[model samples]
Target: MRPTRSVDYRTLAHLRLPPAVSDFIDGGSGDEITLHENTAALRRLRLRPNVLSGTGVPDTSTTVLGTPLATPIAVAPVAYHTLAHPDGETATVRAAGDAGALTVISTFSGQSMEEAARAATGPLWFQLYRFRDRDVTRTLVRRARRAGYAALVLTVDTPVLGRRHRDLRNSFALPPDVRPGNFDADHHTGLRHASPGHSAIARHTTEALEPALGWADVAWLRRITDLPIVLKGVLAPADARRAASEGIDAVIVSNHGGRQLDTTAATIDLLPDVAEAAGGHCEVLFDGGVRDGTDALKALALGARAVMIGRPALWALAAGGGEAVHHLLTLLTEELSDAMALCGRPTLADLDATLLAPATPVCRHTTTARREAP
Candidate 1:
C-alpha cells in the first residue's frame, strides 16, 4: 500500500527489507545513544508561536550555495540504493529533480556517476570518501566534475567505517548482483564476500579508504576539481570555522547519522555553535534524525541553511520507488509550510532564533489562596 507519511514508509521498508539490511539502515553504532539523541534534542525545542500576526501562505522556497530549492531540504547521500530498489540512484535522483531539490550522490552509489547525473534535472552534488588509492580518488573527482556535479562533498568522519554491531552479526555484504558502479570490477570485488561472523563492507573499507586522510587532502581535492567543496560530518564549532577559513563552500553539521563515533552530541544540538562559528562564512547544512518538517523548521531556526533527510529517503524508495520518494519530500515540505504559517513566519527569512524556546516542564501542584485576601 502507498504510505502517506514518512513513518509509514519506514514501517513498510522494515517489512520489505531483509532483516540484516533493515538493521544496517536503521541501527547505529554502539548502544545507539547518539542516534536516539539526535531526534530527542530536536523534540526538546519548543516553538514560540505568534497567533495574531497575519502570516498567510508562508513561502517555503530558499536557495543554498546559489542553488534554488522548493524547500530548505535536500536528500542526503546514501550508499547502495539498489538495496532499496532496482532502479537505484537513478530513480532517487529523478524524483529529487522533479521536486526541485538537490541530491547528493554517494561515492559508494550502486549506479555510475554519469548515469545518476543524467537522471537528475536539478542540481547534483557528489559525496566522496578519500580512498587509499590516490589515483582512484582523483579519477572519481574528475568523473564527477565531468558529469556536471555542482559540488564535491567530502565526508570527513569515517577515517574508518564505524563498528556497527548489526553488520557484524548479519555478516553484511552487497548481494552478488550489487556492486559499486563507480569503480572498475576489480576495485570492488572484495566487497562481495561476507564471512559468517564479519562484515565484508568493513573489510573492503579497510582496504580502500585512507585512515590518514587529513586537511592536506582537502587542498589536494581543491587542486583536482574546480567544483565547490562541502565538508560533511563536522560537529565542532572549531572545525566549522576552519572549513570557512580554508575557503570551503559549505559544511554539513553531522555525526554521520550517529553511525560513527557513538555517544557524540546530537547534530541539532551542535548546530547552533557550528552555525555561529561559520558566521556567514559558508553555508551550514544539517542531517541526523530529521523525520518531519517541524524538525527541519527547528534546524533552520537554529541557523542551518537547510536540512538533509537520509534514512527516510531510503525507506520511501524501498516502500515504493521514485514516486514514493517524491511524495515523502512533498509531505515534509507541506509540514514545514504549516509550521511556518502557524508560527507567524511568512518566509524562510522570517524563521530565526526568536521562533524557538526551550521546552519547559509543567507543574501540577497549585497553592491555596488565603481567606484574608477576600
Candidate 2:
C-alpha cells in the first residue's frame, strides 16, 4: 500500500526491517503502559473549534531557541538510524534540513556527529547522555560545537537503559555492518554480540552510560559550553521549574518515548503543568505519541512550543531513506495546518488552552447492556 501518513510508514517499516530490528524500534519498556497511555491520552483530547472565525491559511511556523522552523514539528533524537537504513542519521539529517525541521543527532548515531552535521542543510542539536568520563563527554560537546551544531540536548532520564522484553526475547545485537560511528570501534564489542535472553543494548548501556550522573553535572555542562541547553526527558513539574531557575533554555517534557521506564505519566498529560512550572522562563518542547496533525495540534494547545516525532521518523527511514522521511514530515506539517484551519486557529499564536474543550469522561465499563458470550 502507498504510504500517505506516518502510521502508513510504520506499517511499511515493519515489513521492510527484520523482525528483531522492527521490534527494537517499535517496542517500549516493560508492560508498555506509558507507551499506550501516551497515544491514548492524545486521542482522548477534545478540540473546541471556533466557527467562521475568518481563518484561512494556517501558520505552522515557530522558532526554537531563536532558530526559525517552517513548521513546529521537529525530529526527536534516537540512536542508530542505520538499524533502519544504511544511510543512518545522514539521511534523516538531510531530510529534516530539506523539510525545514530541526534534527537532534544522538551520541549513539550510526554516523559521526561531523558527518551528520555536514549533511545537514538546517540547524542541528546534539543529544548527549553524559559519559562516565567527563573529559570524553567534554570532547563530544566541543566536537558538536566545532561541527556547527546549534544546541545541546542533555538527556537525563536514561542513566541506564530500560528492560525492553522484545529485545530481550530476540537477544538483539547490532549487525557487523552497523556501528555507532560517534565512538571508538573497541566500544562496539557489546553491540556485536548478545547472550541468550540478554539484549546487547543492555550490555552496551552498562558499559557506556553513566548511572552516577547528577544535577552537578548539569551545572558543570553549563560552565563548559555556550550552546543553548535543552533538558530532555523531564516529566515532573518540579524539575521543570528547577530547570528554568537553573538557566535551561528549554525543557522537553518527555518520558523518553516510554522507552526508558514503563508507566511514567504520558508526556502530553504532563505538558501543561510542566510548561506552567517553567514560568515563561524557558521553552517547553514535547515528545511522545504524536502520530498525526491533530495530535501535534493537541500538544501545542496544551503548551508545547514544538513536538518531536521519534518512531515515525525511523519508520519513514525504513520505508525509503531521506526521501521518505521528507515526504512524511511534509505531509505531517500539512496535516497540522489543515487541523489548525479547521479549529479556527489561523496561526501558532492562536493556539492556546482555550481552543481545547473539556475531555469527555470515559467509563471503565460499557454503558449499554452486555450480551452473553455465544
RMSD of each: 7.0, 3.7
Off by over 4 Å in 2: 363-374
Highest TM-score against the true fold, candidate: 2
TM-score between model 2 and native: 0.96
Each candidate structure's count of clashing pairs: 0, 0
TM-score of each: 0.95, 0.96
Relative to the unseen true structure, what is the C-alpha lDDT of residue 233 in candidate 1, on a scale of 0 to 100? 93
Instruction: Write model 2 residue lDDT over 253-304, tens digit each, in one string.
Output: 9998878899888888899999899888999999898989988999998899
TM-score of 1: 0.95
lDDT of 1 by residue, 1-374 (tens): 76766778888988888887788788788878888778777766678887877999999889988988887889999999988888899999999888878999999998999999988978899999999988888989989989999999999998998888889999998887778989886867778788888899888988889999899999899888888999999899989988998999999999988889899998988999999999999999999989888899999999998899999999999999999988998899989999999999999898898888645332222231101000
Error of 1 at 32 (Å): 0.9
Model 2 error, position 76 (Å): 0.5
Residue 224 displacement in candidate 1 (angstroms): 1.9
- Looking at candidate 1, what is the lDDT of residue 53? 73
